[model samples]
Target: MVNIDGHTILTGVLAHPIRHSKSPLMHNNSFAKLHLNYVYLAFDALKNQFSDAVRAIRALDMRGINVSMPYKQAIMPYMDHLDETAKLAHAVNTVVNDHGVLTGYTTDGIGFVNSLLNRGIGIKGKNVIIVGAGGAATPISMQTAEEQPKQLLIFNRKNGHSFRNAERNAKLINKSHPGLAKVFDLNDRAKLKAALHDCDIFCDATSVGFGKLKDQSVVTDPSWFHPDMVVYDTVYAPLETCLMDVAKKAHVKHVYNGLGMLLEQGAASFKLWTGKRMPVDYIRKLLLKSK
Candidate 1:
């Protein structure tokens, strides 16, 4: 157990390859602001040691952990119970340790929803288009569908496999919320453009704006975005991604980065771990200052 200022505080790490995760900065900063004696770090775990690292989390008396990238799904089996949302998404991003039993949860979905709702962009009765079909997309799509959106559409770049995986995930989401999810092939620009034309919100769930792919953007056409549409990108590093830039230039009503979701989800995980509700405004201000 780690002790800080006589407090036996616990810790967690966002594990992934090339993980310069801002989680440590965001979470540790919050802990400091709240005068809590705790720390959060980042770990670049080797593939073979993933299980070992998770086991160590318990042995070390860690309060909880946040999983990222390749290990989100890989760490599922080690969890004692999965929250309903995590089980549906089949991915666990946050884990809580309750007396050695680690219960898994996915705050990404609800995080994005809370972010949008907090921004006054109502998900209810709005049509949403989510770009990308990877792990990140799963929770976003699943949680968004629960909001009873008028329609939830998913688009992936790769033709066959990507679209298929998205469809399978959509089907799983639809199982809980019937007739609310749809998958589309983005390879066909015409269909993609048509779908965008009818969307009220566009979410970039891909890794198009991070690290080496910072120069890349998923949406190539500006004409597809309208002035009334809201564009939200799940990339926060640059604060403004290429997709967000185009959306702004096009006079989109509300354009936001994933920073809000990041904060809200961290808040959720914090609540799970400590059974205390975090101050949303405090966390938001901290993130803005860091930006």
Candidate 2:
């Protein structure tokens, strides 16, 4: 771990099944490049153990931690304060601990938005369709809605209380940015097809591509994506997901994976931890060099 005279540098992980996380690689590489003495390690915790895990993190005197998957929302209640983005999305992906006080923040949405804009894909007045309504979906949808998209449609496969939770989130997003959000069932093929036809950007926010599930596919049809469509999948492992492959074969205008988002969010969290602006371009170059 990177160490300063007074600050004992440390890092942590917050994912249910975190054995396969690459965040340690990414962050540690950046730390080495910057000549910091900080070390990041992974911690796996079950759903019910999330609160306990946060307590443990506090006791560890860690500088910061990244929250992933199921624990993003669960860790919210344990935080001392929420940043504006975290409060807006009702989720926290980054946390900074300063002498036992933890402040929560969400960098996922801003990372994604920055990545899209960096690629010159403007969200203003564009129709967007987002697949999945899980932890990642909330921030992406909320931030996209705030960007004033012409329309935003969220599709989820299941129809249980989780679906209702998604609808509630959609309402929260739309309420803040009136008349821009709606939720639908992905099982309704006709509706999904129609949405795809009208969408300028399609995002996959599900865990259909990563780790042991990397071989799984999200969307089955290439025809659903047009040459004008920009497909973005928040899945970096395997580099190219099946949905992205479909987009590429369909000659889509643009396709991006989650690497940029990961980099940006990690930089954001690093800033929160150290109160220092990270060399983002260097991190980006590192990622590219790895490819």
Candidate 3:
């Protein structure tokens, strides 16, 4: 059981439909392992009530909270400061309240980078392709671009705002590293096939491979994968996603689920709240066993 007292510091994640979050369990277990006087919880809050939720962080003197979905971009206006990555992505996922001042940071990028690092992989000097431009894909794309990859390719449905987001991201990256980033339509199978054949790292940040769309995959053909590429799917549920399975069937050298990204991002937030590194390996094993 979690030890609660007046001195226990409060931390949590704020999002609508939050009952499915694994954050509370992950952080609470980590806290218990370290014997830290911190308690983590999940709060289900709609958009209108978000301002009040931010105020509660100050009123309760809580350490911080993780913002999700609709709140990631919506929660930014209330922050006193935003870390560079948060500003770059134009979204916030982690907020740290120092005294009464709340600062926002986007750790999803760090999580993605560190997850690759954990497996002895780095994006530098490698051709990289990211298949999405939403919340998960945007930061990953921005961060991967920052890592000086040989080239970065972003794919998204051409008809939606996500396609605009892809164009915006490619433009932003091109500003710093001219001609290093490009955008393409996800429906252009010929281009996607060429990118997969040439790219060294392929990441699926889309929602197609999990939840109600668990059976679907952005890359419908398993033959598109090659042995030299590293494949990563940012969906932890049903751990082995269709994309990962497809990569495996093609004999891709590295296949990973999003569990590491989840752990690493939470670890980054944990460090922001408390100035210590999270025991990532232990937490990884714990989560896997529970799964």
Candidate models: Cα lDDT each: 0.81, 0.82, 0.89
Q: What RMSD, rounded to one decimal, does every model reach?
A: 2.4, 2.3, 1.8
Per-residue CA lDDT of model 2 for 149-196, tens digit only, reads 899998887564458757877889767777678889877888988788
What tens-digit string does per-residue lDDT give for candidate 1 at 1-291? 123665556767656553556677667767776767787878788888887899988898889988877777788999989988888888899988878999989888888899988888788899899987666778988888878889898888665555776888889878878878887777778887888888898999878887778887777667878999989999888888888888887888888988998888888888787677776787687678875
Point out where model 1 deviates above 4 Å: 1-6, 17-19, 159-162
Candidate 2 pairs with clashing backbones: 1-37, 1-38, 1-39, 2-37, 2-38
Tens-place lDDT digits, model 3, residues 46-83: 87888898899999999999987657878889999999
Question: Which candidate, 2 or 3, has the higher lDDT?
Answer: 3
Model 3 error, position 230 (Å):
1.2
lDDT score, candidate 3, position 69: 62
Where is model 2 more than 4 Å wrong at Cα? 1-8, 158-161
Candidate 2 lDDT for residue 270: 82
Quick one: best lDDT, which candidate? Answer: 3
Better-scoring candidate (lDDT), 1 or 2: 2
Q: Sum up the clashes in candidate 1.
A: 0
